[model samples]
Target: MIFLRNILFYPAFYLGSVFFVLASVVSIPIGPAPLRWSVAAWSRFHRTCLRWLLGIKIEVEGQLSREPVFYAVRHESFFEAIDAPAMYDTPVTFAKHELSIIPGWGRAAKAYGMIFVERDQGAKALRKMVSAAREYSQEGRPLVIYPEGTRTPHGEAGKLQAGFAGLYKLIGLPVVPVAVNSGPMYHRFWKRPGTITYRIGETIPPGLPRAEIEARVIAAINALN
Candidate 1:
């Protein structure tokens, strides 16, 4: 029965995503102000679909940062990337430049302030991230980043990337370390059909040197293990 449910669920989820993409494209040239709230609304709907369609429940512990801050999250499953915008009031992600090459999804990402990074052009990517993060922070939105650069296969804590440290120093904002355990349960191919927990830690206040901040983020997340 679970297998049957999974088979039926994916198609509906795909259709919902298509509908969202079409709706977002039609809404874009109108400008970001009006579209911002709508995007958040749709994201919530999308997260709901994932909850029902995929049977993955999410639990968030601790409080999100009170002020505009940067979130360094552990990436593992597709669930976190898709579900983040819904979890926060306004979220701006730092994603790879390749995501923009994708046809439909890329457009939606652009509308929601997804900052694209060119991995090959490291200096340019850091500069862009700083600028976007400053702008988004001023708007009182949290900038979300996967410091590991890519998803860990099964929620293992991967080596932290230097890009996060660079961004932390550039933006000079508080860092919120989010430890997540998503793979033993909601992994894509071997998904266990259960809950995924996002354990948020207290904001690591700014003013420390970049290395210290990076260590703090890593320590906070590792504490969850």
Candidate 2:
């Protein structure tokens, strides 16, 4: 049944993606803000399709604070990336600059408040992230950053990256530690068929030093695993 579902699922998902690409392009001339919301809605629709296709249900926890709090989340699966847009009404993602290079995906990402960082230019990228995140916060939107910087395979915890502390310092907003566990279901290899949940936690106030903040975020995620 899982094999049959996977086969049926991907094609429908791809077709839906193409439609979203068209809707996004059509909305472009209309204006970016509207386009952004349209794309976000489209993404949510896409994830809903994925859930139905893969038979993967999601259970999200903790309140997504009404304020524009900075969310430091763990990276594990494609599910996480897709889940963010669906979960938040207004989400600004801090993704790698390379993602912006992809053809249709790149354009869609930029449309949605997705900021890219030049991997080679470490310091410059950090500064750019802070600036971009602050700009989003000023605009009254939440920023979603995968503190690990990249996706870690299956159950392994990816090494924590450096920018979260700086971003927290720059934004000066309370940090909401998001611990996601999609392992029992999604994986690069086994790809078990089941639901993947995103368990969001309460906001960790910013009084702690940079090191402590990093440790706290990691600990929060590890605890759930």
Candidate 3:
């Protein structure tokens, strides 16, 4: 039954994605505002599919950050990745460098203000990430980063990436860690049905020692595990 559900979901999700990408492309001449709308709509569409077809639901347990602060989210699966647009109101987000390569979709995502991180580029990439995040911060927008850098298994924790600390220190905003347990439900090839809870952890003030902030973030984002 789960396999059958996944079979149904794959086409629906991809088709919906293609529809939104085309909508974004057509809206290009008008400007990026419409692209943002398209992305939001696509996220809603995904949520609907997750609930109805896959019997999965999302539960965010804490208040979202309304101020211009940085959010450090747990990376357990692609579930939270697509849920970001719905999780917060047009917050600035970061993605892996590779996603920026996909032809049409990548262009639209870039226009949507996603900061693609090149994990291997060292200090150069960190500088670019900080610069882009600062501009968003100046605009009173919340920024989100996956502190773990990559997705780990459901019950395990990963080390906080250097870029997470680098951006937090330079962007000069309080960090709010968000923990989610979605791996057991949605991390595999055939996603299971269950609730994915997003718990907003305590906020850490800016300018703390590197070790302290990193330790706090690691503990907070893995709170669900």
Candidate 4:
């Protein structure tokens, strides 16, 4: 049954994404608002497919903050990444430098106001990401980042990446640590039919010394694990 559902989902997800990708690409020439709208629509399309087609639903633990702030999220699957746009008002997401070079998608993401981090460039990349994030915050857009830097298996605790602490300190926004158990239901080729819950932890104030803030964030984001 799961295999049959996946067979239905892969085609719909990939082929549908192509249309949105083209829409996003075309909107680039028009301007930022249209480009962002195209991308957000694409994200919602993914969520709708996940829920109705695959029988996977998302449930929230705490109130999702609408105020422009930094959201430090758990990394379990690509589910949360897609869910960001569906849940926010055009969030500013942190993405890998590699994704920003992928032909049509790259051009669209760059113009859509994402902060690209060249993980290999070390400190230079951090500086660039911080600068971009600050600009987005000033525009009252919510910024989202996976503190562990990449996906991890469900129920496992992954170490917070160094860049996460750097971005949190430099972005200067109160961080809302979010824990999402997405792997159990959303990861793998054959996804399971279940609920992926996202727990929003208490907001941590900015400027609390590095050690204190990092510890708090780690604990909060790992609360579900």
* Candidate 3: 10-residue stretch with minimal lDDT: 160-169
Q: Residue 88 of candidate 4: its Cα lDDT?
A: 74
Q: Give per-residue CA lDDT, model 4, range 1-225, as digits (tens).
A: 888889988999889999999999999889888899999999999988888889999888998777888999998888887888887788999978888888798888888988888988988878888888888888899999988888989778888887777787787899999988889888887898998888999998888888888888889888887
lDDT of each: 0.77, 0.76, 0.88, 0.87
Candidate 3 global CA lDDT score: 0.88
lDDT of 3 by residue, 1-225 (tens): 898889999999998899999998788778878877998898999999999889899898888877888899999899888989888878789999899899788888888888998878888988888889889788877898888888989889898877677787788899999999999999999999999999998888999989999999889889999
Candidate 1: where is the Cα deviation over 4 Å?
none
TM per candidate: 0.91, 0.91, 0.96, 0.96
After the best TM-score superposition of candidate 4, give how far the Cα of residue 51 lies from its true spot, in angstroms. 1.2
Pick the lDDT winner: 3
Query: Tens digit of lDDT per residue, candidate 1, span 87-184?
Result: 77678988888889778678878877999978888798778778878998998988899888888865355887877787887798888888888767
Screening candidate 2 with a backbone cut-off below 3 angstroms (N, C-alpha, C), the clashing residue pairs are none
Between 1 and 4, whose lDDT is larger? 4
Q: For residues 1-225, write the lDDT of model 2, one tens digit per residue.
A: 777777777777778888877777777778877777767777787667657767777777777888888788877777777777778767898887877888777886786678886779888877877888888888888888888888776567677777677778877888887887776677554345666766777678866797788888887765457
